[model samples]
Target chain A: MNDFVYKWRNPIFGSVSVVLFFLGWEALLTWAIPLNPFIMSKPSLIFEGLWLEMQSGQLWSDLLISGQPFIFGFGAAIVVGIFVGTMMGWRARVGYALDPLLTALYASPLVAIAPLVIIFFGVGVSGKAILIFVLCVFPFVFNTYAGVKSVDRLLVNVVRSLGGNERDIYLKVIVPSVLPFIIAGARYAIGRALVGILVGEFFAATAGIGYRIAWFSDMFELSRMFGYILVMMVVAVLFTEGIRWAERAAFPWRVGM
Target chain B: MNDTTSTAVSPVPASAAPVRDEGLGEITRRTFWEANERHALGIGFIVFVLLLWEVIPHILTLSRGMDLFFTTPTQVAMTLYNMFASGEIWPAFKFSAVAFSVGLGLSIVAALPLGVIIGRSHTMNAMLDPFITAFNATPRLVFLPIILVWFGIGMWSVVVVVFIGAVFPLLINTYAGVRNADRLLINVVRSFGASEWQINKLVILPNSMPFIIAGLRLAIGRAILGIVVAEFFGGSSEGIGVMMNDAAGKFQVDIVFAGLVIFMALSLVMVGGVKVLEARLSRWRPENVKSF
Candidate 1:
C-alpha cells in the first residue's frame, strides 16, 4: 500500500486537482451564470451538445472530413519532405540552394497567407491539403537537413576505408542516423498540420470539424463549437501521444523519451 | 538557425577536421560571407531559384502570359514598392504591432506567476501537466471561433486570441525551468534558513532566465500567428491580415506576396533578437551534445 501510494502519488493528486477544477467550473456555471450559456458554457451542457451532434450523425462525418486533409496533406508531407530532406542532406549544394526558401517559409506565419492559398487553390480539399503540406514540409526539411548535414565525416571515411561503396555508406550509416531527425520533423509537422486544417476550413472548407467550428460559432451555438473543440483536442492529444509511442518504439537507444 | 549552427559547430574535437574533404557547415557559411558578399554558391542558388521562378512562365509559353496564378518576382517587387510609396502598409503594420504588443504583454503577465506556482508545487505540476500538454497540442486557431463568439468581432477578439496562443509556451518553459532547479543548491539554501521568497529570488528566478528567454522566442512566433489569424477570422479591418485579405480577394497576388514578405521579415527580426538574448543568457549552458 505504501509503495503503491508513493509510486502513484503525483497521478492521484493531479487527478484530484483536475477533478476539483472541473467541479469549480461546474459550480460557477450552475450558480453564477445559469442565464447565459453563451458567455461561458458548463460541462454538462457541452457534453449534452456533444451527444446531440453525435446522435444527429453530423459529428462522425465532420470528423472524417477533418481527417481527410490530415491524411492527404500530412501523409504527402511526410513522404515528400523526407525525400527532399534526404536529398538535401546528401548533397551540400541542394541544401544551400533550398535553405533560403525553406527559412522564409518556416519563419513566415503561413496563417497570413491563407487568403492567397484559397485564391490559388480554390477552397477545396486539395487546396487545404496544399496548405497543410506547405505549412508542415518546412520543419521536416529543417530537422532532416540539420540531421543529414551534421553527420560525422569520420564515420563515412571509416566505412569507405572498409570496402564499403556509396550504397553501403547510405544504407549502413545515413538511414539509421537520420531516423531520429525524421521523427522529430514529423512530430513538429503534426501540430502544424492540425492548425493548417483549421486555417483551411476557417477560410472556406465545405465540410470538416473546422468548418463546423466556424459554422456553429457564427450561429451562436457555443456549446456545439466547444464540443468540436473538445473533440479536436482529443484527436490532437491522441496523435501526439501516438507519435511519441512510435518514436520510443523505433529508437529504444535514445534517452530523452 | 544559421547563426546557431556556426557557433554550435565550434565545440567539436579538432581531430575530425582533416579526415573529411569538405565541411559544408564550416565552408558554406564562410564562403557565403567572404566572397563578393553576393557571389557565394548559396546566394547564387537562392538567386537562381528566384530567377527561375520569374522566368518559368516565359519558358513555358503559357497562355495569358502567366496571369493565371503564377506571379513573377519583379512584379511582386514593383507592387511592394508602390505600396510603400503610397504609404498604405504603415497603418496595417501599426495595428498588428499594437495588437501583438498588447497581447504579448497580457500573456507574460498571466503565464509567469502561474507557471512559477505550478512549478514549485509538486501537486500543481502533476495536475496541470496533462492539461497544458493537451491545450498546447491543440492548435490555438481552434480557440478563435470561441473567442469570436465571446468577444465578438473586433480587435479585442484578436488580442485575446494572441493571448491564448502565446501564453502556453511561456508557462511551460517557466514551469520546466523552475522544476529543474538544482537540488543541492536548494538544500544548501534551506540549511541557511533562507525564506521561500529569498530562495526563489536568488536561485529559481535567476536559473530560469534561459528557459524564459527561449519561451519568449517561441511565444513571439505564436503571438504573431494569433494576431494575423485572429484578424482574418475576427473581422478586424485594420490589420496586415485585412490588407492581405483585400489583395487576395481581388487576385492581387503581388500584394499578397508583398504582405507575406513583410510578415516573414518581422518574424526573422524577432527570432534574431531572441537568438541574441539567448546567446547572452546561456553562457553556463554546455554546448549541446550532438545526437546520432
Candidate 2:
C-alpha cells in the first residue's frame, strides 16, 4: 500500500495540477476577457456544450462517421508501409533504386495537394482516406527502413553461415530488431493520420470532429468548438498513452535502466 | 582498409589535395565517375517523373478542365512566373521566412540548454519523460487554436506553432547527445582538474554537436511543415500555405501546385543546408565520425 502510494503520487499530482490548470482557466475566463459570455466561452459553458452534444447524440454519430475513414486509411498506410519498407530493406538493389523516389514523395506537401486528391476521389470518404494515407505512410516507411538498416548485420551473417532459411532469418533476426522502430513509427503515424483526417474534414467534410468544429465556428459557438477540441485532445491523449504503455510492456528489455 | 576505399569515393574536391602528392588524378576521375554513375539512376528517375507528369495529363484526360487537376511541369512553371510577375509571391515568402527564422532561433535557444540540463540529471529525465510524451502525442498543430487565443491570428501565432513543432526534435536530440557523451572522456577531463564550465564547453559541446545538428535538420523540415500547416489553419495573413488555400478556394489548381512546388523547394534547400553544415562540423571531429 505504501509502495502504491509512492508510485501514485506523481500521477495524482499530475491530475490535480491539470485540474487546477483548467480551474485557473475558468477563473481567468470569468474575470478576464472583455467579450460577453456568448462570443468567448467560459470552461463551464464549454462543458455545458459538451453535455448538450452528448444529450443530442450528435457526438457519437459524428465520431462513427469520422472514425470509419480514419480506420481504413490508417490500416492501409500500415500495410503498405510495412510491405514497401520490408521490400526496400531486404533487397539492396531495390533500396538503391527506390530510396530517392520514396524520399521525394515523402517530403512533398501532401496537404497542399489535398484539393487535387478531393478532385480525384471526390470530397468524400475516399478523399480524406487518401489524405490520411499519404500523410501517415512516410514515417512508417522511413522508420521501418531505418529499423531494418540498423538490424545487426553480424546476426544476418551468422544466420547465413548457420544455414538458416529465409523464414528463420526473418523470424529470428529482422522482425525482432525492427519491432521497436515500427512501434515508434506507428506512434508517430497515428498523430499524423489524425491530423490529416481533421484537416480533410475541415476542408471538405459532411460530418466528423472536424465538421463539428467548422459547424461551431460558423455558428460562432465558441464553447461548442472548444469542447470538441478538448474531446479530440482527450481521445488523442488516451490513444497515445495506450500505445506507449503497450510499447513499454512489449519491450520490457528497455526498462529498469 | 574500408576507410581507404571509402575515402576514394569522397566527393569533396578539396580532398584532391591529399591525392595530389600521390599523383592520383586519373584514379580520382575514375572514382568520381563511378560514384556519379551510381547516382545517375536517381537523376534518371527524376527525369522519368517529370516526363510522366507532362505526359499523363495529356494521355489520360480529354477535357481541358481535367488538365487543371493533373497539372504538368510547364503549367506549374508558367503559373509560378505569372505569380512572380504579379508580385504576389514575395509577401508570402517573406512571411514564411520571418516566421521560420524567429521560430527556429527560439527553438534552438530554448530547447538546447533545457535538454542539456535535463540530460545532466537522470532523475529529471525520468520524471519529465511522461509529460514530454504527452506533449509530443498531441499533434503540435492542435496548439494552433490555443496559440491563436494567446497571440492572436498573425505572424506570432505562426512562429509559435513552428517553434512548438521544432522544439521536440531539438530537445530530444540535445538530451540524447549530452547523455551519450563518453563517460570515460568526462572522467578524464575531471581528473585533469578542469572546471565544470571548461568540461562542458570542451567536451559536452563538441560531443553533442552532431546530435544537435541532426536535430536541427529534423527541426528545419518540421518547421517548414509547421509553417505551412499553421498558415493553413491559423489566420495567417501571407505564406505559401495561405496562397495554396486561396488558390484551392478559387479552384486555381495550377497556382496551388505552384505554391506547393515553391514550399517543397524551400524545404529541400533547408534540409540540404543543414546536411552541408553537418558535414562541415563532422569534419572537425575525425575520431567522433564513425559511431553516430
Candidate 3:
C-alpha cells in the first residue's frame, strides 16, 4: 500500500498480465497439446500473418475502404443526431410524438435487418453509410436529448434574470454544458459505426477488413483471420483512446465525466 | 409552511414516519407507455403510426406495384399468424431465446465478481483498466470469427457473442456503482466495527443495485444485437435471425416485417419489464445523483 510502490505497481502488473495472456495463447497450441492450430492459431503466427498481409498492401486498402464509410456515416450521425435530439429535448410534444417509434427501434435488432437496407440503398458506399447511420445515431440523439433536458434549470433562470437573451443563454450556458455529452455520444457512435462498416462489408462488399476477415475465415486460414482481428481491435482501441483523451482535453475542469 | 417551521422538533410528531406512494410505480410505467394520461394521446399516436404503416403501402400499391419491396401491416400480421400456425417461428425463437438468456446469465455471473474486485480496489482498476476499456470499445462482432473457429457453428458460439456484447456495460456500471458508494456511509459502517464483507453486503451491494439494473437494461439491448448478429454471421443458420435472413432472401417482405414485429415485441418486453423491475427493487433505496 505504499504510495511510491502503488504508482508503478499497476502498470507493471498490467504489463505482466498481458505478457502472461500471450504466453498462454502461444503455449496452448501444440507441438504439445494437439488442439488444432488451424482452429486456434497462436499469437506469433497471427502477427506473422498480419505482417505478411501488411507487406502485400492488403491492409492499407482495406483500411481506406472501410475508413470512408466510417467517416461519412459517423459524421452524418453526429450532425443529424444532435439536431433531432436537441429539438426533441427543447419541445415536449416532439419527444412524445417520436417516443413510440424511437423506443421500438431502440429495442429491436435493426442491425440484423441489413438486407432490407440493401433493398433501399443498394450494396454501395451509400448503403454502408446508411447502415452505419442507423446504428450510430441513436446513442448521440439520446445523449444529447438527456444532456439538454438535464441542463440545470437554475442556471437558465439565473441567466434570464441577468437579462441574457435567448441566443446568449443557448450559446453560453446550454452549448457549453451540453458539449461534453455530445462528445461522449460521439465516442459510442464510433464503435457502432465500426460495426456498421464491418457488418455491411461482411454481407456485401468489395474491399474492407470485414470482407478479408470473412474471406480468411471461410478459407480456414485461421492465422490470417486472427491477424485481421488483431489489427481491427488495435484500430478500435486507438479510436476510443483518442476520444477519451479529447474528452479530457476539452473538459479539463470536469472530472470522471 | 410557517407552522411546520415553528414546530421543527415537535414531540410525538405526526410526520416522524415517512410515507410512500405505492401506486407510483404502475403510474410511472403507464406514463412511459402512454406518455401523458391527459387524453391517452400517446396511445393514439402509436395507433396512428401503425395505421400509417398499413395505409401508405396500400395507397402506393393501388397506384403501382409497390408491395414487393415493402408489405402492408395486414400482410405482416397474416404472415406472423401463419408462421405461428405452421409452428415454424417457435424453434428459431426458442434457439435465440436460449442464446440470449445464457449469454446474459454468464455475463452477470462473470462480471459481478470482477466488477466488485476491480471497483473495490483502486489497484485492480488501474491494472485492468486498459484491457477492459480496449475490449469494451472493440465491437464484439470482431470476436465472431474467432468464436466460430473456437466453438464452431453452434449455440455455444452464439452465447459467447452475447456474453461479449453484454458483459462490459454490466461490469463498468457495477464498478462505477461500487466506486461511487458514499464515503460517509462507509466510514460510519467502519466505525461501527463492520467488516469489508459486511459493508459490501449491507451497503455497497444495495447502493449499487440501481446502477446494476441500469447496466442490465443496456446489456439486454447489446445481447439482442449480439444474438441476431451471431446468428447471421457466426454460422448457426437457425434462429430468428436465420429466419429473417431467409425471408429477406426469398423476397418475403411480409415475413421479414413479421419477424421485425417479433423482435420489437421481444425488445419492448425485455427493456420495459426490466425497467419496472429495477424500479421495484430500488423503491426503498435512497436517492442520490444518478451517475447514469
Candidate 4:
C-alpha cells in the first residue's frame, strides 16, 4: 500500500485536490450561499454551457477566428523581429539608435492604442494581426539582440582564424546561439499575442473568441462567458506548454537557464 | 597579436585618430563623445523621428484626414501640457494611482506570506501547484468581465483587476526564491538550534530579495496594464484609461498619445525605483548570484 501510494502520489493528490475544489465550489453555491446564478456560476453550469457551445460548433468557429490573427501576427513578428534584431545586434549603430524607442514601446501599455490601430486597419483580421504583431515583436527583438550580444567572442575569433567569412560565422555560430533566445522570446510572445488578440477583439471585432466573450458578457450570459474563459485558459496553457516542450527538445541543456 | 585584436575589437576607428592630429581639447571632446555615443545617438534618433513625425503630415497633406488618427509629437506634447496645466489630468491620475497602489499593496500582503508557506511546505505546494499554474496561465483580463459583474464597474473592479494581474508573478517568484534559498544555510541554522521560523526570517527572506524585487518589477508593468485595461472596460470614467477611451471616441488622437506617454513615464519611474531598491538590498550578494 505504501509502495502504491508513493508511486501514484502526484496523480492521486492532484486529482483529489481538483475534485475537492470543484465539489466545494458546487456545494458552496448549492447549499451554503445561494447567490444569483447569473452573478456567480457553478462548475456544473459552466461545463454545461461549454458542452452546449461545443455541440453547436460555436466554440470551434471562435477558436478558428481567433487562431488566424494569432498565427499571422506571431508568424510575421518572428520573421520581422529576427530580421530587425539581427541588424541591431550585428551593428552597434543600429542598436544604439533603436534601443530607447523600442524600450519605451515595450514598457508602455500598447493596448491603449487599440482604437487607433482599428481606425488605421479597419475592424478586420488585419488590424488584429497588426496589433498582435506589435505586441509580440518586441520580446523577440530584445531576446535575439541580447543573445547575439552574448555570443562567445572566442568562438567568433576561432572561426575567423580558421578562414571563415562573415556569412559562415553567422550561419554556423550566430544562428545556433540565437535560436534558443528566439524560442524563449516566442514563449513570451505567446502570452502577449493572446492579450493583444483579446484587446483587439474586445475593442472592435465581429468574430473571435474574445468577441464572443464580450458578446456573452454584454448579453448577461455569464455561464457562456465562463465557458469561453475556460477555453482561453486551456489555449494559454497549451500554447505555453507547447513552447516549453519545444524549447526543451531543441535545447535540452538550457532547460533551467 | 594583442594590439591587432584590441584594435580590431575597438569601437573607435583608428583612422579617426590618425586623420586629424588631435590636441588635448579635441581628444577630450572625442573621448566624451565616445563615452556618451549610445545616449547621443539614441536621443538624436528620437529627435529625428519626432521631426519627421511633425513634418510628414504637412508634407503629405495627411493633416486633413489622417490627423484624427495620428497626431504630431508637438501636438501630443501640447495636449499633455494642457492636460496638466489645466489640471484635467490630476483626477484621472489620482484615481489610477489609488487603484494601482491599493491593488499592488494587497497583492504584496497576500502573496508574500502565502508564497512563503507554499514554498516551505511540501503538502501545500503539491496541492496548490496545479491551481496556481492554471490561474497564472489564464490571462487575468478574462476575469475582468466577471469581476465587473461581481464588484460593479468602478474603482474596486479596477483594483481587483490590478491585484490579479500583479499577484501571480510575485507569488511565483517568491516561491521560487524560497525554494532556491541556500539549503545549507537552513541546515546550518537548524544545527545551531534555530527553529523553522527563525531560519526563514534570517536566511530565506533575505536570500529571496532579488527574486522578489524582480517579481515586483514585472508586477508593476502588469499592474499598470491592468489599470488601463480595467478602466477601459470597466466603464470607470475617472482613470487615465477612461480619459484615453473618451479621447479615442472623440478622435482626439493627441490626448490619447498624451495619456500613453503618462503611462509609459509612470511605468519607467516605478520599474526604475524598484531596480534601485533591488540594487541597494542585494548589495551583499555576489554579482553572478544577483543576475536574477
Candidate lDDT scores, in order, read 0.82, 0.79, 0.83, 0.88
Residue range with the least summed lDDT across 10 consecutive positions in model 2 chain A: A32-41
Candidate 4, residue A126: the lDDT equals 94
- lDDT digits (tens) for residues B98-207 of candidate 3: 98999999999999889889999876887788789879989989878878878988899999999999999999999988987888999999999999999998789988
After TM-score superposition, the amount by which residue A148's alpha carbon in candidate 2 deviates from its true location, in angstroms, is 4.0
Worst 10 residues of 2 chain B by lDDT: B1-10
lDDT of 1: 0.82
Report the C-alpha lDDT of model 1 over A1-257, residue by residue, as the tens digit.
Answer: 99998899888877787788879888987887664856567777888999999999999999888888788988888888888886676665566667777776788898777787777677888888889998998888888877777666667667889989989878877777778888878887999999999999988977889999999887878888889999999999898888888888888787352
Index of the highest-DockQ prediction = 1
- Candidate whose TM-score is highest: 4
lDDT of 3 by residue, A1-257 (tens): 68877678877778777787888878876456776757778888888999998999989989999888888888899899999888767775666566667767867878876888876688888999999999889888888877777676666667889998888788987898889999888888888888898889889987899999888988889889988888888999999889889989988887466
* B-chain TM-scores per prediction: 0.82, 0.83, 0.81, 0.88
Q: Candidate 2: global Cα-lDDT?
A: 0.79
Q: What are the per-residue Cα lDDT tens digits for candidate 4 across B99-215?
A: 999999999998999999999987788788878888887778878878888888788999999999999999999999999999999999999999988998999999988989999
State candidate 4's TM-score: 0.92
List the candidates' TM-scores in order.
0.88, 0.82, 0.86, 0.92
Compared with the true structure, model 1 gives a TM-score of 0.88
Off by over 4 Å in 3: A1-5, A27-35, A152-167, B1-41, B61-66, B183-199, B289-292
TM-score of 3: 0.86
